[model samples]
Target: MQSIKNGLVFIAVFIILATSCSKVEDTVIHHPKDPNTTYFPMAIGNYWIYHEFTLEPGGEVPTGKIDSTYIEKDTLINGNLYFVYKSSLSLQWEMIMRDSSSYLVNYLGEIFFHAKSIGDTIFREVNLNPLGDTIFAQYRIMHDGPDQIQLPAGVFSVLDATNVQLFPKAVSGPKERIMNNFYAKDVGLVFRNYFLYGKQHALKLARYHIEK
Candidate 1:
């Protein structure tokens, strides 16, 4: 009888250990970023604030414009749900969405965002509705692995979404522009470095919240 009781206790302990191990494994197996979005998180209530400035390369960067951007909410446009953001430009809206494979940035309703892995490249010429304005964008996945970046708010392990745009002189503001956007897992854009003509501007996150 004594030996049988000991055997039962051992089985019970083994079962408990197995259950604990399974739970740990489940945690490890879960994805790091939100399942719906990666480079740019589109959850409701997620927002980013930026300090826009103008700087000459290897020179002083005097603060110019202080810009703040945030996602207002999710709205269904033309039967498709899109995360809308506040913008100064007079367009339909600055929106973002996710498909099965990747995140898409709708610059005034244009599907211009692309690239997910290293060595990936996306090139497109998107047209702004009714204005006859055209935008040529070329993007290459410079880094898709683990990387750390420091912002005005904090440090982060970010996935970089780097791109360059060839804009017409009418819209390019007398120079071309490039953007190196840094995004954290589960968080939206945390940092961005914008280069136009002979000036550089940084958009650093002052604060952010990833909606649960």
Candidate 2:
């Protein structure tokens, strides 16, 4: 009886996903400084290979998605220079991010750009997309300096930052989200982990090409 009920639930979710909206939220990352000098380098021709891991709603195992993201070029928006990072997840799907500051902007949302350091806690501005909304983003430096961590991509000393997002009514039973980013100086992001909908998802830098 329990197995039958679970099967029905799975089928229902699959149907919903198959017919879901074609438009996805845009994610924007803004960085005004030279990517070459920042924790993430933004030289054209530079590329990062990322492995995405998504878990089943109630499972601990993960499924992989995505392959590589290349820093193709830079564009001017509102007279502001922004680096473009494009991720071709599949033949039919793509995700792009505009790096302005440490903040990223996408069709999904935007994070306010600013300087950050260790032990700094701040409430920054965020302009999200899809619904085209603005809100405050609260961030904290969970760890700074050198954090030696290992990922499938490689091992590196990283600068870690954490953010907590609250949702009034999220999926099923979740109401909050926690995201942590591990950035490798020069190489950019090494790994990222987040908990959403009571499930854990992650991304790791598998390989990279940085231009001189």
Put down candidate 2 lDDT per residue, 91-114, tens digits, no spaces: 343334555556545434444222
Worst 10 residues of 2 by lDDT: 10-19
For all candidates, the clash counts are 0, 22
Tens digits of per-residue lDDT, candidate 1, 70-163, equal 5666777666777766543324435455432474645344333333554555444554646665544344344452345555556566655556
Name model 2 segments beyond 4 Å from true. 1-37, 54-62, 90-115, 122-142, 168-172, 195-198
lDDT of model 2, residue 184: 70
Residue pairs whose backbone atoms clash in candidate 1 = none
